[model samples]
Target: MTAFTAWQVWGRFVVNDSPSWTEPASVLMMGWFILLGSAVGVREGYHLGFDILVVVLPETPRRVLVTISDIAVTGFGGAMAWYGYQLAAGTWNNVSPALKIPVGISYTPLIVGGVLIVLFSLERILRRLAGLPEPHLEADPADSVA
Candidate 1:
């Protein structure tokens, strides 16, 4: 996201005869996807949860359920990483208009975010197994519900 923004900024600079962007803007843009996913997690406490029945359960069961749910979520991330890589690799030749970069570059976020989700899920699972507190999967009081 930031990369795209930077691209636009650099594009303007190029037009205005200012210094051109030096660093690879795509890398910066890719970071935005990861940041976006993290923001989602932070906003919701966790991104993976069984929200349907959780509201009716007591805290204990709800925590246990969420922990269990995270395992599946992490596995899903793994699957996404695997499939996303294949998809990206398969479409690497296709280019975008603004960036003229490979279409696969956009999917980098999916791969990276999937890995991050897996790591977070593992952390949550370990915390659960170690009897540490499970992280909240709900938004803060002030945040709108997902």
Candidate 2:
């Protein structure tokens, strides 16, 4: 939906300035940005507990901090998923902007993304508990795969 609208806007730009196309295009761009931000862990990295503080800590403190962080993130995800599901389901009757699409449909991403983060946090927590190496959010470009 967003991609199609973006294409439509691009086409409009190629032609002449049409308010109809521009309006939806702007809206689509905003939605796309929000979706992309929510889908990836990038946004989470910038939030509460994620930072360079852990990097300077001793190994024991670092491990403890990361474990605590994982638990907190998992809890956050659980709450978001639960409340988001309720919001989506309870507000299913509301109409959206643009195409009058159901507002609940827009909230589907919140549930999905929250669930995904929960899953990721669980895996990380398990890894920490098992004394395995921590997974970096981004792989080093020069690291060899084996």
Q: Which candidate is the best by lDDT?
A: 1
Model 1 lDDT per residue over 67-139, tens place: 7788788888788778878878988999765556897876777777777777777877777678775446443
Count of clashes, each model = 0, 0
Query: Model 2 clash tally?
Result: 0
Flag regions of model 1 displaced more than 4 Å.
1-31, 38-44, 51-60, 135-146
TM-score of each: 0.60, 0.66
Quote the lDDT for 40 in model 1: 60
Global CA lDDT of candidate 1, please? 0.68
